[model samples]
Target: MKIITLIRGTIRELAAKATLYVLAGISTLMLLAAALAVGADSTPDGKTITFFGKQASPPVTNEMLADLAGKLEAGFAGGLFLGIVVFGVFGTAGVIPDALEKGTVDLYLSKPIARWQLLLGKYFGSVAVIFLNIIYFIGGLWLIVGLKVGVWNGRFLLSALLLTYVFASLYSVVTFFGVLSRNMAIAIIAGILYLLLVAGPLDSRQAGLYLISENGIYRGILDGLFYIFPQIPAMESGAMHIIAGEHAEAAPYAQSFLSSGGILALSAWILHKKDF
Candidate 1:
């Protein structure tokens, strides 16, 4: 019951944000366009290009349609991922810090919930928002692709799971910063920096750095950072595997799960000891 209350409260706070609504509106528009395109029988051959019932040249085969669907799914994945990191981080990064604000902290502490429960509840609730949003976006695309192409790609739906895991992993970092700093700007900046360093070149460039850096301490530090941060590249590869209908190894997913769990545990511990 305590966790439910926190979930409801966090969801309500997210819904109150303008960013959520704007993003939702954009997703809805895309879904609408996709729906329209699905039903328009522009050509009996299924060869013509379509846009909201508008027909274009170039006859396409079922194979072509399947390939198009796959490519579209991949492109959507890339865009949705960027949106998830940007809008998702900025949208909910403040939930923990806001809860910890002066008067707000007092009220929550007075409640019957345990500190860990409250923190975990909020964490799960934020992830829930992302889950629902992804469902809406990907669900629409899945249906549109299936209906238009006459091929239901089960892989598309499965990609949602991998993508959600990715978002949740990143959100754990955002939550940690929010809990530690209790400042929205600091939390947001930290989350962005984390992505730029851990997910960006720093992850891939480590190998070359190790080869060039003669200093043992510098090499050690690079190796340490590499192992410390969640293996985002591995998770991303897993996502691609889902899209491509290939078997993905469990190691990357497992690594990301353990890392995310570790971060959440650390956040909960910090919140437990923290005083308003």
Candidate 2:
């Protein structure tokens, strides 16, 4: 019951914020507009309108439509996944620190609940908000694409689960920083920095750098960090593979699970050890 109350409170606070509303509105508009554009990808006229008016790029076939839909769905899912993580940092960054506020922490600690339960509840509650928003937004996109392209690929729906996992993993870091720093801005900034560093360069630029580096120590250091942090782009690629109806390796899922477990475990440990 205490956990439930904490979860409800976290959600209510987020609901009262304008950031969530603005993000939802923008995501909905983008997905809806993209669905409409994809619906018109191929017309009966056997021509597509370009800057120079209708031109015969080629006649669209079922195979082309399927391929295009797969690519668009993957791209759209990836965009939503990244958006969820970025906006979620802003949305839920204060949850832990707010709970840990002077009077607030006292009130919570007086309860019969264990400290770990309180922290985990708060973490899961924040994750629940992200999960709901992503599911609602991406599920709508999946339906729209199915209706528009006449390709009912159920695998695309798996992107929502993958994305929610990504957010959960990233937000665990937010929770950790929120508890450690007790400052919302610092918490949010830390999560964003991690996202920018790990999610961006770690995939392409760092991989190439590691490949060309002759220094054994340098390569080892890079490799260690590479495997330590959650490889978000790789996970996103798995989601894309599911969307494209291709066989995806299980390594990404395993990595995300391990990363999330490690982060949340560390968070719990810190919260348990820290003084209110």
Candidate 3:
């Protein structure tokens, strides 16, 4: 079987499902809020909304763009991760076991192809669906940021790339577990727990992005749990740093793009050696 054909078929199967309701709602809210802030200063009309110490008609500048981008990135990632960590519980819930239970896995297994190709084809197909959705998600974010500032950040585009990579990393692990149980529910639960309860704690350890706000208790848990979830994408932090302008003094999006490629390669390797 052609890998491209198989990958395309799986993605088409998933595309027919109505997954846009969530994206539509999220886009609407983000756009509305961003527009209000950018064009109207948070007050839709004649209402006087406070802007800290800044005057009513604040001057637009790159510094202001950086500040807004940081806040937006923080909120976007926080909410996006929260949604993934929760809804991922049912995202690919029945992919594996259902197919295997229905004997579909056997059918695929019977094909005159290598196990690696079969596993890789399935992984790529599922990942393709994920990739499209994440791109649309980033589009929503950029539309809002652009409308608000009358200028789009190069950082937003770069972050979009990283966000997609992170999604792939999280879902790749989920796919691995899904293959193990051939059960959808189990795989989703495994992924969610890893992303939420495991990944966060693991990275904020002894060598974490230590700071004052996070506190020691949080840092200790973060450090201890870093390696437990190997699928944790380093791009998650790198994206945030870029939007916050923290990377201004360092290499330009160097860390994020490199991390993205690393996660993709890691996921591909995992799928290549996978039994299913």
Better of 1 and 2 by TM-score: 2
Index of the highest-TM-score prediction: 2
Candidate with more favorable, higher TM-score: 1 or 3: 1
lDDT values for all models:
0.79, 0.77, 0.56
Q: Please, what are the lDDT tens digits per residue for candidate 3 over residues 55-79? A: 4444445556456555665567656
Provide backbone clash counts, one per model. 1, 0, 10
Pitting candidate 1 against candidate 2, the one with the higher lDDT is 1
Task: Choose the strongest candidate by lDDT.
Answer: 1
Give lDDT tens digits, candidate 2, residues 126-149: 888888888878788878877765
Candidate 1 residue lDDT tens string, 128-168: 88888888898888888777756678788888878888888
Question: After superposition, which runs of candidate 1 have C-alpha atoms over 4 Å from their true positions?
Answer: 33-64, 206-221
TM-score of each: 0.86, 0.87, 0.69
What candidate 3 gets wrong by more than 4 Å, as runs, is 19-25, 28-62, 207-228, 231-234, 248-276
Stretches of candidate 2 above 4 Å error? 40-57, 205-208
In candidate 3, which residue pairs clash? 93-184, 96-182, 97-182, 97-183, 201-222, 202-225, 202-226, 203-226, 204-223, 205-223
